[model samples]
Each structure stands twice: as structure tokens, then as C-alpha cells.
Target: MAFGDIVQGSLQDFVNIDRFDTELCVFIHIPKTAGSSLSTELDRMRPPYHNIHRKYFYGDTVTFSRIEDEIAAVIDSGALADARSCSGHFSWTLAAPIRAARPDARAFTFLRDPVKRVISDYRYSRTPTHPTYKETIERFPTIESYIEAPETQDKMARFLMPGDVRTPHEIDTFISTNYAFVGLLEMYPLSFNILSLLLGHDRMPSEHKRKTENTVDNAVDETPRLRAMIAECNQRDTVLYDIVRHKLLTVRDDWRAMREQSRPAA
Candidate 1:
């Protein structure tokens, strides 16, 4: 069966944020999916915010062991207890801990077309303005090499489904079950709708603007060969992307319906 077809319930059916004791918002950032823009907007909207990135936790080396302590310190300080929202590369790891401290915290994220996301990520990594530009160029001298690297394979699914999620079905179910919203990078307006719904606001902060990264040309030529190549490299990601796209549409429609229903004698 198709991945989207397998989902038996709507996203709202799985969401239960009203039951939380303390309110927190977590944005699980998947690279190259307009996550940076959303994070910036959320940082602007939500106060007492904590933003975590790989560099802050791991630096040039992996420090998986120290994550718990860092998370604990944030919890102990009661920063998370207050009205706070956090966005980070390590969002998935922080999700459970944040919820533990603040039972009402909601976690959400965005996904993009996997092929486009991979290409954007490669181009971004090579841009001089990017933090990891040196390391990326040193490691991946060419787009072909970058495409073949293990790091580029199903990166979104890998980050979102970090543990024992072995199949596309598991990934779909996990996201639907956990996240308050799964937004689309391409559908910014509708994605904003879902995000605003979760944020308990009618609109996002007016001061926040969409931040574009690595404005380099999109990495691929317009041709069947290039398109097929990118797709072949992202089979798993495509499945997850398709699922999110479908869910995002449903979520948006449902929200609109709710808003319409709640409207009084208009």
C-alpha cells in the first residue's frame, strides 16, 4: 500500500496538547527545508527561548554523552518551565525531555521535496558564508561525490526517525503520532497556517521575515537525467516527503474547517 494511504487517522486526532501541564514549543529542524526561517520566526515569537545546534552540543566532535546533562541543566534552571520555545538540530533528542519538564510542550517541523532539499543542502554547505563551508568543500569536492555520500541519504527521515524506525510506515506513524504539525517547505503560506494554529495565534510575528540561505543557483540542470539521479538517491526520503505533503494538506484543510465552523454568524 502507498505510505499516505496507510495513515488511518487525521493529524488532529493524534494531537493532544491541551493535556500538557506547562507550555513549550519545540521546532525539530531538518536542514535545507526552510527550517532556519521558521526557527528565526519562532525565536522572535516565543520568549525565553533556547536554540540548540550541533555545534553547540558536539562542536567538531560528537558529544552524545553530554547531551543529557545539558538538557538537565536547562530543566533544572526552570527555563523550560517558564513560557519557552526551542528550535534546534537536536530537537528530536530534546523532545521527550522538554515534554517531561513541561507536559504541554508541542513539537513541530517542516519537510521539503527530498531531491530539492539534498541539492540545496549541498549548495549551502559549499557556500563561503555557511559555517561548515570549509569542511564541506574539503570532504565533498563535487556534487556527484556529495550525492553518493552516506550523509545525504534519506537525511530528513534519518533525523526525524532517529531510533529503531526501520520502515517508511514506522516513520509516517511516528511523526503523525508525535508532532503537533508537520509543515511543507514549498507551501509556506499554508505551512504558516498550521504553525500559527499550533502556536495559539492568528498570525506569526510581523517582524519575522523569511531568511534565504545560499542563494546559489539550484544545483541541478533541468533534464530527466538529473531529475532521475536526484530521485534515485532519495527513495526513502521521497516516501517520507510524500507522506508529510499529504498530511500537511489534510491538516491545513482541517484547520480551515475548524476556523470556519467557529466563525459566528458571518
Candidate 2:
């Protein structure tokens, strides 16, 4: 039900930091994840929220370099203490300035199954609902093409990895070592409970701020070839997803009990 109960290792193996101890909690928002909904729940807790400007999302790549720079500047300007938490689509390195400014600040993020995430992202991109839908549609008309593009390769890794990290184990070590918690989209209930426990929440809100995937009407075919291509392109993301699943869901007796309860009768 909590971090100690669910996570594979002992709480002592990780940091003792939590909402009570930290000046700021950082939420590294990856696109197509459930961050918006989680952020809304964070809002209900009545803490000051800092959102990195979405304007960069609408701008070109020449500008992606500037968002964290601007945010890092804000941290340097001594603006971070006023906010309870900050959430954005910035890389893991964004935490560097925040941690320097507020040493106790903790960060967390959610990861999704790579193939499903891409399928959702592709469909999301073709619609006006996505911020850069027009450009996405103009550039990559097919799901295959979209998944094959360099930008789409390891979409999750783009936000998670900092330098030329080669393998998924490196990412696993990074998140496990740095992040306060890592939530899996497939196991949101357990993930949410762990988050609530660590954040010292008395009451938990389950409502999602928005369902972006519901906006897209057409579903991708998800043929065998397409799935394999998606796996190949997102090797790091895929392995990380599997690692989290095995770590959280396979080793624990509680998780096995939950699986048994949800299992179909023979």
C-alpha cells in the first residue's frame, strides 16, 4: 500500500526524503502520460504549483534548449522556494538547478508501455488537440513513419536520459537512484497509493484532468510488424517498462495477491 510495501527494496535503500522533508517536489512530465491528472490532484492539496511555460511546446526545437535554461534561471533567481512543486516536459537534468537551489527537493515521473504510448502519440499528433498537430501531420502522415522518425525514437528516453546513455539499465539505475518514485501507467493504482503515502496525503483524489487519448477517434492497426518496429525504435523505453513491471509486480507477495484477485476464474 506504500513505498515500503510495494517497491522492491527497503525504504532505507533509497533516500529518506518525502513531502514533509522537501522544500520542492519536482514532477518531470513526459508527453502522453497521466501527468496532467496527477498535477490536478497536486493542486487539490493546496500547494503552490510551478508549471514550466507551455509556449516552448508551440515553438521550434531551437527553443527546447531555452525552457530549462529559463527555469534554471528562475531557480537561480530564488523563485523556487515560493512553489511547492514544478511540473514540465523538461529533461531529468532540469532537476540539477532545483536540487542545487533546494537540496531536499525530490523528483518523480511516470512511464508507459512504449508501443501503446507511441500509438496514442501518433493518433494524438494527427488531431488539433495536440499543440503541434499541424506540424506533426505535415511531417509524418503514417504511424510507421512517425515511429521510425529520429525524434520519435525512444520518446520516453528523450525526457529521461541526459547524455549519450546507451542502455535501459542505465536509465533504471538513474530513476531508482534519483527519483522519489517512478509510476507505471499500467499499474497506476499501486503507483498512486505509493505516491500518496510518500507525500503524506490524508485523502487521495482520483480524477484525471483530461483524457487526451480519448480525443483521437481512429485507432492504429497495431499489426505485428508495427509493434516490432515500435519495440526496436524504443528499446530503452521498452526495457525500462519491463524492468519496472517485474520489480514492482512480480517480486512482491501483495502484488501477486492483487493479481490473483483480478484473475479470471477457470
Candidate 3:
């Protein structure tokens, strides 16, 4: 599918990323993108409160099935009145209820390297730490086998679609329209710096940094062929990631120039 050029979102500028002007803000917490740590930080900083839907990082079969749809019921039941911010793993379409409730609420998300995130997610799922551990161990025994499953395809993009966004082009446009900001997990510190600007809050503490170790041993070898297959499954998410990274590059450059200019000269 064809991809679109990175059209910048409406919430940024040369020196500062504009904070959302509305009272309520929203976060689309995509999985395996350091979203949990970011969610914790977001919950700490929002004005009155930050609403968490399905706080568990992982769940059983039933939770996995209802995780994305549960937020809609809460919003429909008039639970949003006291909510200063909403965050969850809900699908891109499920956010419609929140948007309908607070038309002015701005949204944002953080993206990660598609390939790495898939690998990380697979590794994380294999352990007994999460609710789905038993299920994952029984079904998919290896990274290769995991990628072969339909459930493992383009997850990042899937959370953002179900609206004419099947192609890469639609993915970029959808983000530009739906989100006020996009951060990258690879540049975790810098991304939160942008988030700080967006929320007028202090930078998050370092303790919340994402864990980098791969502790799970699924007992199967991974090769170039396996990685290639994973990449192929996430073509559109790759497009989406690249588009945001490119825009962030521009932001970084502009920010550097502004800082250098402001420095006192000898």
C-alpha cells in the first residue's frame, strides 16, 4: 500500500509542543511501547485525575477479548464527567465515545520500532508474570510460531484502525487527525520531554525507565528469516513509525537550533 508524506500534527511548533487547550486530554496507550510507564506518569500529572481503563498489563482470554471494548461502556454510563484524562488499550474506534463526550479533548500516543516491539511482546508474554502466560506457552512455543499467528500482525496499526485506515497512507492521515502528539520509545527521554511540554508538567523520574532485559527463554532460535516475516506483517506500522520519527527529527533539529541560539556567547 502507498504511504503518505509526514504531514505535521496541529499541536507542535519550533521551540515548544503546544499543550492541549481543553480540560480533558486522552492517551491511546499502545502496547509494548513503554506505555505502562508513560501511563503511570500521565496519571500522576493530569489536573484532577487520569482515568485508567483495564489497568492490568496482561489478562486471561476473557480480559484480552474485552480489554479494548470495556472503555466504551464506562464512557456511555456517564463515567467521564469526573475524568480529567482517559487512557487505555482500546482500539482507535472505541475512542469515539470519549471524543463524543468531550469534543475538545486532545489525544496522543507513543510509538516504537515495530520489529523490536513485536519481539519484546513475544518475550514478555512467555513468562508467568502476566495473566496470559499459560495461554501463550501452550499455543505458541517459539518466536517464529508467534509471528505466524494472525493475532500477532501489525498490532500497532490495528490499535489505530477499523476506519478506512487499511493502507499506509490512511495510517499517517489518521494519526495526524486523531492525535495531538506522537512520541517514540527509542528516544524515551526526549519523547517525554515533548510530553512535558504538552502537559506543562515536570519530566518523569528515571525509575520508570523501561526494562531492557529479555528474561524469557521460549527455547527456539530466531533467525533473519523470522525477523523478516515479522517485518512483513507490520508494513503499515513501519510506515507509521517512520512518519512520526521523521517529524520528530524536525522537532529535534529546531529545538537544538533554538537552544544554541539562546546560549550565552564568550
**Candidate 2 lDDT, tens digit per residue, 1-266?**
21223354444232234444345777888878777788877665537777775453344541334676778767776667787877887878755777778776777778888888888778877776666667777788778778888888787777876767657667667666666777888777766655665666534447854655544433578899989999988888887777677766643455445446656799
Candidate 3: which pairs clash?
none
User: Among these predicted structures, which one has the highest TM-score?
Assistant: 3
Model 1, 115-205: lDDT tens digits are 7787777877777556656667778877777888887888887777665775778887777677666778787766765466455554533
| lDDT score at residue 37, model 1, on the 0-100 scale | 67
Supply candidate 3's per-residue lDDT for 22: 46
Off by over 4 Å in 2: 1-21, 56-65, 202-205, 213-219, 250-252, 255-266
Candidate 1: segments with Cα more than 4 A from true spot: 1-22, 54-73, 94-96, 204-222, 251-266
Show pairs that collide, candidate 1: 20-104
> Could you tell me the lDDT of residue 181 within candidate 3?
74
lDDT at 124, model 2: 74
**What are the per-residue Cα lDDT tens digits for candidate 3 across 1-266?**
00111234322342143455345777888878878787777777775545546644543353443654566566667767767777887766878777777877777788899988898788778766566777787888777778888888788887876745866667767777667778899877767766665676546445474664455464435678876888898787798888788777756755455446546797
What are the lDDT figures for the candidates, one per model?
Answer: 0.67, 0.69, 0.69
